[model samples]
Target: MSAATARATIQAYYDAFNAGNAAGMLDRVTEDIEHRVNEGAIRHGRALFAEFCSHMGVSYREELRDMVIFVSEDGTRGAAEFVVHGEYLQTDPGLPEARGQRYVLPAGAFFDLKGDRISRVTTFYNLNDWIAQVST
Candidate 1:
């Protein structure tokens, strides 16, 4: 894949995310995709990814804003920086109680690409910032 194609793939993934289309997002990833959640465990495969998406669908509603994507010249790596504008819809285990609390947090994801699909996705954000925002 060319850098341009990788960038477009990342853009399309985020587009699917903002659209709340889990299947669309999955379609951009490899069958054995690796998902590294911020401050959480690394999950493998598309099925696990789908499970995570399902849980998140119930716990939060989010839109990625101001996204900017960068891809390596080799097109094997990519990253995106964005702000998450989100509402906490339900309480997630080991997290704060949710009564529709809303938050805006800066986040980013690093991707490892294979061909045209994402082989790995590792995401990051300020957990403390998120806690403070939703705690109040």
Candidate 2:
């Protein structure tokens, strides 16, 4: 894939995410996609990704900051970096819950591409930051 295509695919993935459609996002990823979270190990397959999204539930809002894209020299993979701000609207036991008003937390993600879609995703952020904000 060309740099332009890689960048486009990265943007499209986020578009699907912002649309609150995990399946839609998964549709654009490769079948054996490997997703890694900063807090854990590898999460394989689109199905596992969907289960994660379901566990997290719907977000009331997300603020993406200085989002940038980087395509690998091989042209078969790409990565993205950005500060993601999210409001807790739904509930997830694995994650924190806001009891009043809302909260804004920073998040980030890095996805690898295979042809026209992402085949791997590595995410990074401070889970402790989220815990500190909601633990109260």
Candidate 3:
């Protein structure tokens, strides 16, 4: 894939996310997608990703803003930086209790392309910052 096409693919994934179209976002990834989360375990497979989305939907509502996407010259890698504007709706196990706390966090994600789809997604953010915001 060319760099332009790779960038477009990543943009489409984020667009899907911003639209709250989880299925559309999943379509942009491979069946055996590898997901690496900051301060969390690495997980694999589209099914797991879907499950994660469901859980997140119940716990929080978020949107990405000020997104900047970058693609490798060879079009096999990409990265995106964005701000997450979100509300904590429900508490997850081992996390602070939620009462509709709002937070703004800067986050980034790195991607690995396989063919035309994303094979790997690794994301990072400041967990302590999030905890602090929601705890207050």
**lDDT agreement with native, every candidate:** 0.96, 0.74, 0.94
Candidate 1: residue 9 lDDT (0-100): 93
Q: How far does residue 124 in candidate 1 sit from its true spot (Å)?
A: 0.3
Off-target runs (Cα >4 Å) in candidate 2 are 58-63, 94-97
Q: Give me the overall lDDT of model 2.
A: 0.74
* Candidate 1 per-residue C-alpha lDDT over 1-136 given as tens digits, one digit per residue, 9 for 90 to 100: 9999899899999999999999889999999999998999999999999999899889999999999999999899999999999999999999999999999999999999999999999999999999999999
Tens-digit lDDT track of model 2 for 1-136: 8778888888888877777777777788898989898878688987888877776555445556677778877657777777766666765557666564354566667767778888888888887877676666
Report the error of model 3 at residue 117, Å.
0.7
- Best-to-worst order by lDDT is 1, 3, 2
Clashing pairs in 1: none
Q: After superposition on all CA atoms, what RMSD does each candidate show versus the true structure?
A: 0.6, 2.4, 0.7
Give lDDT for model 1. Answer: 0.96
Go through the candidates in order and give the clash count of each. 0, 0, 0
Model 3, position 100, has a per-residue lDDT of 98
Candidate 1 residues lying further than 4 Å off, grouped into runs, are none
- Please provide TM-scores, in order, for all candidate models, with all chains considered together: 0.98, 0.82, 0.98
Error of 1 at 92 (Å): 0.2
